[model samples]
Target chain A: MMTREKFEEAVLPPVVALLVAMLVGDALILLFGQSPGAVYRMLLEGTWGNAYGLGQVLYKATTLTFTGLAVAIGLRAGLFNIGAESQLAAGGFMAAVVGLAIPAGVPALLLLPVYFLAAALAGGAVGALPGWLKARFGAHEVITTIMLNFVVLALLNYLISSRFKVPDTLHTRELASGRLPRLDAFLPAFHGSAANVVLLLALAAAVLVGWFLFRTRAGFELRATGLQPAAAEYGGVKVGRVWWHAMAISGALAGIGGLNYVLGYKGYYEEGFATGAGFLGIAVALVGRSHPVGIVLAALLFATLSQGGLAVNALVPKQMVDVLQAVVIIAVATSVPEVRRLLRGFRRSNDA
Target chain B: MMALAFLTQTLRIAIPYLFAAAGGVMTERVGIIGLTLEGYMLGGAFGAAVGSLATGNPWIGLAAGALGGLVFALLYGLGAIRFRADQVVVGIAVNLLAIGLTRVLLRFLYDSSSNSPRVPGFNVTSSGSGFGALAQNPLVWMGFLALPLVAWILYRTPLGLRIRAVGEHPAAAISLGVPVTRVRWTAVALSGILAGLGGAYLALDQHQFTDQMTALRGFIALAATIFGRWDPKRVALACLLFAAAETLQIHLQGVGAFPSQFVEMIPYVLTIVALAGVVGRAVPPAALGRAPE
Candidate 1:
């Protein structure tokens, strides 16, 4: 029932919230006895100060982009998929297994697809459980997904410490001979950097997701189910199917997020390597208003903050970064009502 | 001997969760699903530690912990009831805020991150033998004793009727002249007090406090609230079930039966299985997460 104009109107609130959050964050920096102007300069400098920093920023952004998309997809379907962390862990573990198990004689081109597929399958299966339960039994996904997160974490911890433990290290075995090619080798011009072609793939995935959600019939059905399930069912939409499909797709997206980590940065699975990406993905999805393009922008912005946050640790406590992220999420969530009121007021004023 | 040890361990682990879940049932019965139970518990633990450390009196710490819970519950009530914020989002925010604020305060107060100084233990005495072989913390006994009392308050009291009425049908209750908002707020605040006391027990009973010590207990309490089907008696039973699982894991570890990591995973895994099976038909309050119009 949201017209194009109304959708645009809905978009303005998150944007304003982001601006206000930034202002508040800057104020917080000042309260911490740091110069806001200098901090901003340092943030930009840290993120884009040089080639290495930019590469790290892009590298971090690539993983976040996928996770953000995963969360956004679930949000669109009215599901709060907090299990992305566990799904990512599962996917990363599986991908590491696949990457290591492949025959050394195999070509990189052939093995890459296998690694990606395995990760996607593992993550998708993890996601499917809560999705199926929600669809079949009307169970709340939030509680089940969170519980599953713990289950997955425990399972991963067991595997890494026991069966999958590399002989010498606390992580899995090094990736097989035929795995994702090194980013430096793939892009000769960007020598000695973590930035890879994965960024492009992430961008392409975002575009495809955007088109799918905005243009396709399935997307329309999913949105309809989310906005008003009763009405969607009345319109002959299979609400359960949409929920299942959306969650499956959401899981796959989160799985790819795990894939990005292995394929781009670490190239191996380490226990507890993903600190809080899945949870942070929730904040990203919320800040972006569950739109693919918005998610991409938000992910990049967060990636910059995270990267810059590390560089400014000497001047400010690292916890400040978390404070900023928390502020943004709180501001956006709390501003929704005000935004609606503002929009209604504007409309009334225009009519008057 | 093993069984006795297990029973004692289970009581110790279950007491905090029992208090929290009892509180959760009270709030949920009033139509507000409290997600910040963990935060309140953590606040209580920290507050108790700080107060006892400063005052050299464990009782004062207990009171301070309850006060901390009261303050947090008030914030949640204001946001969810007064401002009509999304309950779940507010819950998540409260949790994150608790994490950030706790860390900040720890650094400010203790100058360290790991553990606080030990305090005087709670008062308790063990006696008898055989079935009574298990000596219990006085707080543990109090937690158990509170169950029937809570059940009484929920089912036998006039205030309980008003609370249930508001939860079930706010408009109808309001039409009947019940102060719906006041009842809901009271339920929330009372839940906070219980959760806070649970947290205080963690510090005062255990004789120490540590960062993240109440890890995920709040979530477990919420799960217990659901598993109990929003009934005080059932919730206490659920808490005991979860606590038994935790106690079994600890016992297995004490005897070196399995790797500690594997033992630690039992509670989480069992919770998932329990949710999938026993929690299948649990119905939450009809308007549990909704804001009053």
Candidate 2:
């Protein structure tokens, strides 16, 4: 367990960033001629005041958590897997296909695991290609991953619009099996919201990832390679292999992230379902300091902002939240080292 | 005849990529990674649309676009250069900022979310002269001129040598009395200006600014810069090649020869393949993406 001091050190930068972002947001709101306090009050009430609002927050948080973990894993391996958006889309598309085509006799419980595995495999395939290219050909993962996003999105669009379209719509048919149960069904407080069992799955995945990263030899190798490839190579670690494994695992996590949207709520693959979640994951990873618990808290914070944006959309431009989020990410990332130094100085003064 | 028609479309499409790639080459050459080209382009597009709509002049719109790009580059420089923030993170932040800022601005300016009203486009006169079609838009002519101009500036000037020198070894350049941050800021500003022009062309050509009008063209241009070995002339050639692919995709869509989505994927897939091929052969600037001490 982290001591109180350690927790404060870990959390201070993001909190400062968030506060700074809100100040900037308040200025923006004032520019738009709206009362920032009123808008903020509405946002707070909208997201946390009712069961439905709380449920929506959890639903969004579920997706954010998975994608955040995906980005965190990539960062661990020193790769910026911006293709998580595409990977999530691919995984969701594959899951939709499997869910739709599975035998009617198969139980939901059995098919759930199949959906998860298929999504991971599909996402992993795309992820590993970039990783292999980086390891083998010395191509930068950033450009390759970015290029793959466009390719995958176009592929998904083709598959859904032409091959698997439901008559005249831009979505696939609703799946017959492997649909996750709505959280409201089990917990009445989530009634009418899209919150589902995927929230639990996301939390479990986070714990699993934390355990793997801290306890596993493969994870250590991956981290070592990221920190110092020459040193890792000298230490006899297969750095290239670590790259492939890390990227594949990162992609798998993003693929499973699709479950929050496709299986949990939509029950079908739809156009633009994974929009912006992948990019927002970068913010979550940075704000959380690339830790599992930090990621969960960061995800929830962002989810609340998004959910609250909808609540105050009538009064102030909800786009303010986007500005705030960007500001927070930039502020935290840029100020963390300086903040750390400041804290150290204060500690030294106290010691003296 | 068919080839001529294809070539015309290719030239038209390649202009934006050429402009953006030229900017990207300069930025990377000056040892500053510019992933914010996408954001710069988006800002330029929005600025051009609003400017043209408000002023009824394409030239004013062009200036507005460049100004928009410069503004974004300044913000980026503030973070990446002044504060020593991570360039990659700053680039990503710029993109998100552009997207969000443009959307909000669009809502305020046009009272709509998806697109802006059509602005006056340049006149296309067909006088049956040989140069009639080519003279359709002055911007296209500008695109033709940009390649050589950038090449001359980058290859044949003292400033060019200094730019390259600062990129290669900033410490050495500083020792020689070169201001490293100023040079980088100038390069980034130039990148923004060119990318803004590219974005303005999209808006002025289409006669409207839609959300994300630049799409992934900025990134494609960045890829082109990489594929072309970061040389101005080669980057222009890569832009033309990618543009040819895009023109073919349009033609293919008309004939239903291939799935349109597959056609859409061609440029990106080719970029990936090209990047992989060039990794060993085309070396990046020695100090690319490194901050000057």
Candidate 3:
């Protein structure tokens, strides 16, 4: 089953895309008067080479994994859930609010579940809006979801600014309890980094998601709907219901993504925090080909580049990393199966 | 006087939306997604700033802005049209690249992080702060002209008919011997020119290019295109309506404690509502976002 050809088919496109993206990066670095090799080495030394740097990379990857899964699940149902950014913020706000609302006497066991549910519910609610819109009214999810990002963020901004923000600051009061422990508690080498048990939660979510998408009947329905909605409906799948459920589940995953930053690291939700992660998750999901295992790897690759951008900032602008990301997405988009088939001389008129 | 000021402010704000919406309507009508309107505006803004700074001529800056947007549109066209990549994803990529490339160019060309040096622009100080001042800005007049020009071209021209034909039925158009690819390419280029002028409007009016400027105005314009249901006259009305909302935002500042953030949400919220078919259905072109056969 695991033939060399199959393995190559699975791995070749992203590998090729990454190499090409790096070449583009090299040109940019050189344009800025820095040796690409030296800068890249410095990047590696700063991220994968050092334990602390690796921890930072993992921390960033944890958030990406959640949001990436959110995007991938919706993609499976033929929805472009572009509101992961909005959902993530809503989730963080809920987590922060829930953490603060619970009585201090409550056991950790009870409080943790409450916070998690609150975050998930908040994110799911936000995610469900666009889904419901699409299902009931034939609205396009892309436009609605993009609009929702601005709407939800502004709503949260109004709430935090007017009602909840600590005076003289843009963030709310820090949670006094239920904060997740840092990796330094056990992994002493990860000192000074924000890596934590949330990484375990993310990995667990990935495994669960992988199983749900590949093994379950509902997951099959979602995938089938994505492939051909009319045929899926013919086969007895309620395509609209799948759209709603997929988006809600996708949103719930993105909501928990916020816990990695809010509860695990910052213990509070700050305005504009995790701003780009939602967009970056789109890149991650696409690059990973919407696979769980692949998303983890893609997340790590991006995290390295992101953390390394800071490392190489003295030599080249950190924005170079953003450029490389765009190039990578472009390369990946150009090579996806549909385009590949077109390039392979498939004729539109040929039914076979 | 206050009403006149409000009208002038609304008109000034409407200029960019008008230009960018025209661009959005153009590309989408020809079947390419108009997601890159934001990116084009940004490209034009930076290009206009650099041109004006180097040459001290606003007209030259305007041309540079158009060229910059054209370059981005071509890049997007290469990805979406030539490679037949997912149109939405390719559009997002170009937006990302535009932001990154602009930032890099900002630092490389000017060595500043937040803004470029102030440039010469069309806003003439001698004309005072009323309609006369607004009139002196040539771009504003062009902005006012945008909807009518597009409407006439779309309804009355052979090329527009071809564009509509390709969008609605590319296969039939191919059978009819129309060059579908060339028509789309031309349409996208035209979109770039229109949107590039919109971005130039922002830079020329502000007299500087700030970091990551254009700040979601392009999305609002895209929303206008949707809110108008892709009709030129309706889209112009949508643009004016959103521009008025923005104008009201400034006037409502600290009045009755209305949060400016809520006002900012008006356009996006309305667009989503329209898309939800609370209003009539907002349909796209039949061939929109389809991969080439």
Candidate 4:
């Protein structure tokens, strides 16, 4: 029962932006004297054709979903939390510490919840610091978050290298408990892939976030504060309190991403493991238009490109994926209005 | 001799930040956010590298870097100013683009993902000690002159008046018959050129272009801009202060008492502390991030 106009309004810009991104990507591939069509086919086959590829794609998506949700939540509150990278590190670090600390005999059920809770709290605490700074001192969140990212990065490096490093290794000790079970072990089809039950948790979290944003009182206040702080303040909303809460939730979401990477896949927290996943969250949130459902689709698309980059490594520069991702974000940022106008023109012609 | 070494090293390190922070001041003072300064720096760095590599002339590299930064800045202005896209989003997007483009081009040209071959640079090492050493590098002298030049343009000129007017209140400026968009575009483009020059200094100083050679100096320059309260003179001094932190970190690491990571955190932690109003309040120009409607 969906109308064409509704579909056009809702979907056309991202679709066209993605197509533009692909076109730019193809041009880059051609510059290397490779056939763009063949390269793309290889990418598709490597990311989607096999069970292992799909599993890898989904596994990456699991982390993206958490980071995407983190940024999206911040965006909904009119805050740009560029420090998701730092929050993820904090979460992963906390999870690693707690996982290693638990006595060897702890049950998985109890240990897993404890691990997740510790991560969320640690990340939330890190996230709330920036929020408190902003609310108290009127400091811009963008700069503070960026500064915090470097602080976290340096802190993590110091901790790992000085105290937590296992002998000469660049990572902490492996966990004795709290590791999430792999989905492939039960499914068999996803064999050889690290895709795990954490993906289900990611999906469930997305649903819960959607519910929280659209169907809750705090959500209404938060959105109001974002849209118009003065108006929201006049409406009896505690704007500062909302910033603190929104940032805490946002950081908690990014923190949960740590569970996916550490407990779900790596089984230990390593320096540089989060890598650029935190930054990629910005693109995912932007492309998805800050919607929960849209974020999943966008995350999958980006994850495919990432997995495919590895697939096409022999044929093209691995940096091609970075180009495509950047192009997609730029294209979406620049071309959305034009796409909307073009769609409107087409719709008017049809009406005539 | 030790004090002279510290001073020269601090000046050398501060040059890039001074250029970037000045550029940021220009753009932000004209009512446009200069988050794209990061991208501009990267673009300039890559351009300078390629130009120097191709021509074997470091001066040509400097020109190419400015042009590269100008192009990137213009693109950013087209989106954020002309198209009225969200400024922060466009800035972040442009930064990512610069990273990807620079790396890909680096690979295509040098066949390596990490760094480029050493090119000819201004040999300031033989320029003697103290002020003579600083004068040996043409770029360093230019950076020093740039501070006063920017201050003059920002304060004493008619264009500066118009720019400040637009930034403070674009609608008011429009009512007074000023072309707000054109002024902002010019400010942004000029800012890019300056930032680009800063990037150029990185490659020329190191005599090679490495992946991410700017090393987030653009962001630090932004901190400098804030700490300086968007004043050219203050920002120049702030850049030196930050550079001092870097130099001190290096010295501390050489002493080996503290962990290297703790030293690395100095500038970043200070920026956070400063932004949190520990030292003083830093207010941005009104209407700075808004597009003219």
CAPRI class of candidate 1: acceptable
Q: Quote the lDDT for B230 in model 4.
A: 83
| Per-residue accuracy of model 3 over A181-225 as CA lDDT, tens digit each | 889989899999989889998999999999999899999999999
Q: Provide per-model DockQ scores.
A: 0.40, 0.65, 0.75, 0.67
DockQ of 4: 0.67
Better of 1 and 2 by DockQ: 2
Which is the leading candidate under lDDT? 3
lDDT of 1 at A236: 95
Q: Which residue runs of candidate 2 sit more than 4 Å off their true CA positions?
A: A1-9, A341-352, B123-136, B278-280
Error of 2 at B196 (Å): 0.6
What RMSD, rounded to one decimal, does every model reach? Answer: 3.5, 2.3, 2.4, 2.1
Question: Which residue pairs does candidate 1 place in steric collision?
Answer: none
TM-score for each candidate, following the candidate numbering: 0.89, 0.95, 0.97, 0.96
> What clash pairs does model 2 have?
none
Question: Global lDDT for candidate 2?
Answer: 0.85
Candidate 1 C-alpha lDDT tens digits along A269-314: 8988665788778777877778787788788877887888888866
Best model per DockQ: 3
lDDT of 4 by residue, A1-352 (tens): 5587766666876887789988998889888889999999999999998999999999999999999999999999999898898899899999998888786766777887898899999889889989989999888888788888888889998988888889878888878877888888898999989789989989998999889988999989989989999999999999999998999999999998999888988888899888788778888898887889989998998899899999998898888898888878877877666667677898799899
lDDT of 2 by residue, B1-293 (tens): 67777788888889888888878888889988868889889988888998888999889999998888788888888878877777777788888888888888887778777899997767776543324555678888888877677788778998878889988889899999988888888888888988888898899988999988898889988888888888888888888988898888888887888887876677677767776785346667888877778
